[model samples]
Target: MKNISRSTALFERAKQFIPGGVNSPVRAFKAVGGNPLFIKKAKGAYLYDEDGNEYVDLINSWGPMILGHAYPAVEEAVREALSCSPSFGAPTAREVEMAELICSMIPSVEKVRMVNSGTEATMSAIRVARGFTGRDKIIKMEGCYHGHGDSFLISAGSGALTFGYPDSPGVTKGTALDTLTVPFNDLNAVELLVEKNAGQIAALILEPVVGNMGCVPPAEGYLEGLRKICSKSGIVLIFDEVMTGFRLSQGGAQQLYNVKPDLTTLGKIIGGGLPVGAYGGKREIMDSVSPAGPIYQAGTLSGNPMAMAAGLAMLKHLKDNPGIYDALNGTANFIIQGLQKQISKYRLSCSINHVGSMFTLFFTDKKVIDFASAKTSDTVLFGKYFQAMLSRGVYLAPSQYEALFLSAAIDKTIADRIIQASNESLEEITK
Candidate 1:
């Protein structure tokens, strides 16, 4: 068995300083029931824990390492940039180049502004939408996390079938009132909310491909319906592509689904695993932000040299190799197929939702198209399966609510090992 003595001790020490001994809540492994693995380093497709045990990484640093950990080009770019120092409150040519590249890749974003994280991007986008539309209320899908922004933390309430209730303690009732929450893949609920709020709704935001509620994909007509509704209702549509940005395709979910929104929030792959985010869209909407217009959004480290250099290198690589998406999808499909065979052999009531390089295996027979169905998954069984996989040299997301992100570092050998590990884990958990 892998020795976790060091990791356990580290966690105990972290608890004295950091909340729950983790910077992020899920990393606490509360749902999976164990001391979280404290990774010391990562390379290619694997992570080495502080305990000196190795694991085939499935999280991929929460969907950033598309080209995989320690990518030569990105690493080189960051190293070269380090000699110039880290931050500059003023603008740089790299930021201009990065902005230009993003505009060229995502046509919907005629203009772009860099931020430090996805939460900042989403929050700023919502504020921009409200300022531009002269409306206060916004629509967001249930269980779709746009980060911990106060407005985005609202959940669905009993009234109007779309009324929102504050999910967190700090969120005010007034903030919840301005934010309407509806079920995913349910156009009717969105339509109802828009109709009820009529002319008051400023924007409708969602993950075109949700990863927060475990890789739940949009229904056949869902995106199209949303597009039509927003167009007809004069609501600015925002696609939060933090997870789906580069993972789905070159232009993100907007290009993959061919559904353009008025605004888009992006993170992950763009930073090459660094803290970076961007929100951009129609020229008119973007012009509403800062120096150019009235709405104010600014960041001192928004386009830091190191982050821009790293992101530019990563995006350039991905752009140069359009085939990466195909390869990623093929690998994800292979793993999915293998897992499915194991699921069948075990006679387990499980459901898998996969898209491109992102996937989630839910311990539920019901299809998890929305939060309601996703909640039906057996958490107890999944916890056991998670531990089983971990014990056998595989590392998955600590929470069932998160999706497993595959990296390009995974080769045929790594893929086979992951599948074999899954097979053993399924059998052991079921038995």
Candidate 2:
């Protein structure tokens, strides 16, 4: 068995220094009720934890390590970039190169802006949209997380058609008032809300394939219908592709679904597992951002050289080797099918949703099509399953709300191991 005593000791010491003994809230394992594993290092599909136990990793750093951990190309690029400097706080040639690469790959983008996180990208895009359209209200689907921005911490109001309110404490009522919440895939609900707001609506922002509430995909023609409605009402359409960009396809969900948006926010994969975010769209709209237009947004470490080098390396490689997606999706399909077979054999109450390389297994018999349905998943069963899998050296996302990411590193051998572990874990938890 893996010796977790060292990890427990570290967590005990860390709680005195770091809040919840983790830099991120989820890392504390609050939802699963356990101390988080302290990973010493990772290579390819395996994670060597503090206790010297290795696990076949399935989370893939929340969907960034498509090429897998510590990829040689990405590592070398970061090392080369560090030889020059870290940040310039001024324009650099590399920045222009990155922007050009993104614009070239993404059909809707004529201009782009770099930011530090997904939250900044979405927040900045909304501001620009409001400024250009002269509108104050923005619509977002319920349970869709757009980072911790004050305006996005909203819940659906009492009525199915009402506006949003603060779902978390510390979010002011005024901030919540300007944000409207709607159920994903319900195009008629959005149409009615847009008709009611008319000229006051700024934009309709959503994850084209909802990952925050598990891998709930868009309904047939749902995106096309939303686009038509946005066009008719003159409301900006924003696809929060932060999770699906690059991972879904080289062109992201926009290409996968054949529905374009006015703005796209990207993160995770673009940074090559680093902290970076970007937003891009039509030149006219992007030109409205500071130095070129009225909406102001700036960052000192906007294009940190190390992050740029790593991202450029990863993007360049992926752009050149389009077959990476095929490999990743193939492995994903293999695992999904194996798990489905196991679930059927065990007669477990579960729902599995997969798209390309991202998937989620929900502990419910009903399909999780939206936030309300996603809430019905059994967390207690998931917690037991998580421990079972962890004990057997198969690492998955610690939370049910997150997606299980696949990478090129997971071969047939690793897939078999995962499948076997999952089978045993299901049996252990269900009993």
For lDDT, the strongest prediction is: 1
Computed on alpha carbons, the lDDT of every model, listed in order, comes to 0.90, 0.86
My TM-score estimates for the predictions, one after another, are: 0.97, 0.96
Q: How does candidate 2 fare on TM-score?
A: 0.96
Which numbered prediction scores highest in TM-score against the true structure?
A: 1
Q: lDDT per residue, candidate 1, 1-431, as tens digits?
A: 67999999999999999988999777888878989989999999989999889999999999999888899999999999999999879999999999999988887889999999999999999999999999999999888889888898875211111112338778888998898989999999998888999999999999999888788999998999999999999999999999998789889989998999999999988888899999999999999899999999999899989989999999999899999899999999999999999999999989899989999999999999998887788878989999999999999988788889999999888999999999999989987
lDDT tens readout by residue for model 2, 289-383: 99999899999999778888899999999999999888888898889999999999999889799999999999998888888887788877888
Tell me the spans in candidate 2 whose CA falls farther than 4 Å from its real position. Answer: 156-166
Tell me the lDDT of candidate 2. 0.86
Off by over 4 Å in 1: 156-166
